[model samples]
Target: MRTFLSVIFLAAFSLFSFAQQPYAPAAALPAKNLAMFGRGLYPGNDTTYHLLKRSGFNTILLSSFYIHADGDLYSGDSHQPIIHQGKWVGDAGYVKRVKDLKTKSSISRIEILLEGRWYGQPPNTFDFIRDWYDPAKAVPGIVTGTGKESTLYNIIKVLKEVLGADAICIDDESVYHSPSIIAMGKIAADLNMHMTLCPFKRNNYWTEILEASDNNLVDALYLQCYDGGVRNEIKDWVQGLKPAQPIYPIFMVRGSFSTCDTHKGSKSVAEISKQLRGFKKDYPGMSGAAIWQMEDLNSFVKLGCAIKQPSSGTAKSVAEFLSQLKKALKKEL
Candidate 1:
């Protein structure tokens, strides 16, 4: 009886020690070739999906995920839950469309974007991560050591399993807790998913997380070069992070946020091309670039921007924009 009790104690102690171990860093993956954010992909029609499949973008980032106080996951301002109480509660049609896009298109990667901000509104998604993530309870795969698991962990797993997401794009504009992010990164790495940082500012905050993750879990940095990050320079960010991963500059196209042109950060096609040329010149090793979103591309077309249309002129605006972007990145223009 004493021998049996001793064996059980040893097993429990081993489990405890294993749970307390820090996450092992893995090698980073290559940066995306050409990426676009699908901010308006949900509730989209066949036409939009068709455009995306032929858009020449190799990566698609589904944007703007929010986590409620009740641990329900929402996309953008949609009332429907993508994950309710750590289960897949999202639309079946939406998942099918995403899968179909990947199957038919040049899209090699799909990343779920988690954005948090302080617009003087209620608590955001990262805030929930900060509140719920306890380091002592965090373990690989099962984040909460307890069998119940954490809402964040469940959400990550569901995204990977259901939507076939390859990475989690961190767009934490307000909440900057390192422990929570690092813990989240560990969980992501364990699940065979990479983490990408979308930072407009806060270099130090990002640097800390990168250092803690051993600069491997984070494969790329999508630097916002528009809006609040208008003043951001690639050289400055490169010098700051000293990153092993590639840094892609994200540009906001014309007609963002319902504006026809010349929004705070929105740039015309010509302007974007010029900027990309300059960025490539500054960082000779620049692998690729990304567009801010798809909604803006549609907006530019609807707002009657003078885009050179094909013979049909049907869906030519989006195609034209993408063509120009690809040319800008490829050629030395």
Candidate 2:
């Protein structure tokens, strides 16, 4: 339970104000999105998005959503536009450029993950402490509970009109005692915003979360199987989670130059394939795979020890990994 994602770095980006194109929240895609960090939305470069659409990844997970004291749901991160050198910019033209690619690839599933803790219960409120560390981290979520209940309604109202986002990821690390989540689930369902969750350790928490949300509201679950010293084995985790909803394992991709890597996975292409084979053999069903933070993709693509061929890590590695993953997912469990 003692693991979290890394923050986003300031990447060079350009902005394109396209009169804020229409934001249409499409039907939720199957749970296989790539989890990313700041400038958010690959905030890395235009190539990031282009490569992803090429890499066969279906969804993009921009991290961190916080609840402001003002009841405004701010994105702790995500593909939020910012000012650099006194100029308004957006993912260095990544968002603007990738906008056209969405319909072409399954990568159309764009979501933001919300995390951190909250205090109190009465006002039905929580704290957005992640913003305290850095104000630039405040990305927006639909505001609720305050004087205005339509905050979510409003975001949905203009989703396609402004950011063109399609879904929300509940990364509520706070575990605050409140009805907000269950309530939010209802809102997501009504708005047709595909909702996802990242729950770790507590099975009861999973139970409670599912209990709170409406049936089918949580379209997918991305389980973190690395960093934390838990029984992260997919065979072990799926027993409880799969029954609730479709679950995808998001493994931590190892860096290329690292020697002292200390997590359960970091399995080479063949090793990962073997693991998927084992999962398939056991479950006889289930599918999809995801990785944390697309920034380390070069490292992620660099295959680990169990390589059987040269050029172990390449864009090919991603394509191969995803192909095997999709195969396993296609199996009927």
Candidate 3:
């Protein structure tokens, strides 16, 4: 009987120890502040560093790599895509800059959005039509159809070698099926990285992508709702996401160009704060939100809206409004 009691005690102790194991935060929860800063296509510059520091940004999302013309993987106009001529881009010293900055800055995460689609497509900025699709420059076994042989697989392989980033955003032009998305997700996992899928549309394209997510491809759903001042529409879209899944709302001020438009008659930062406060109250599960840019502060003023700048009128006003919004959000939470 004593032996039996001893065995029971041991089992209880073992269970207690297992339960006490350190808790790793769930990947779905929005990371601190849910704040992601967008850098211009080319951001290896001083202005970018100043803007990121002044703003309360915690993540830097960059688009520095590109598959250049001439069938080279990493050779773009200015920066070479890391995996050029079958070589790693990071090894070539591009991502090294990002890592160096990351070590020095308080930003906890860095993401490289890999733009996909063969040369000659609508958004193919590489002039891929002239270079990658040329029949003569093609490498027989590897270059395949378009001669842009750096398939999603090859491009990612090089990126992993270089950036060693915490996350990768798959900016595929036209994603339809789950297998393709899941395939991409598996590739990310193989590299010990998390994936964020950007499916840009107001249509039902995301419905199909959501169906395909069976623990394979994505850690977060990055939806770009560029319409500003439409609080109800934005609320509806947020509600449409799966109740349990995490969603990051991308609020645009430029590039996608939502900030240049009228703010539905609100002429000041105070009015904008009122709308944001209402939205935060309506949506409790919102992990966090991100602005499309740090530039374009002028566009808001032209539309008769104002922001708090650091010094003087613009910075001070905008900061107070943001602080108030933050306080209101905390109360709601």
Which candidate achieves the best TM-score against the true structure? Answer: 1
Off by over 4 Å in 3: 1-31, 41-43, 50-54, 64-82, 89-94, 116-120, 123-150, 172-177, 202-204, 214-217, 227-232, 254-275, 294-333
Best of the two (2, 3) by lDDT: 2
For candidate 2, write residues 102-179 as lDDT tens digits. 756756667656555333332222343322222234335433341124444443333333445666677654454335
Error of 3 at 296 (Å): 4.2
lDDT of 3 at 170: 55
TM-score of each: 0.83, 0.64, 0.61
* Residue lDDT tens for model 1, 160-195: 889888889999888888778888887788787789
Judged by whole-model lDDT over C-alpha atoms, candidate 3 comes out at 0.48
Best candidate, lDDT: 1
Candidate 1 Cα outliers beyond 4 Å, as residue runs = 1-32, 118-120, 135-148, 307-316
Error of 1 at 269 (Å): 1.5
Q: Rank the candidates by TM-score, best first.
A: 1, 2, 3
Q: For residues 58-174, what per-residue lDDT tens digits would candidate 3 score against the true structure?
A: 666665345544334542224544455666533334354655655555566666665555442543422342233334555444442222243445555656656656566755544
Q: How much does candidate 1 score in TM-score?
A: 0.83
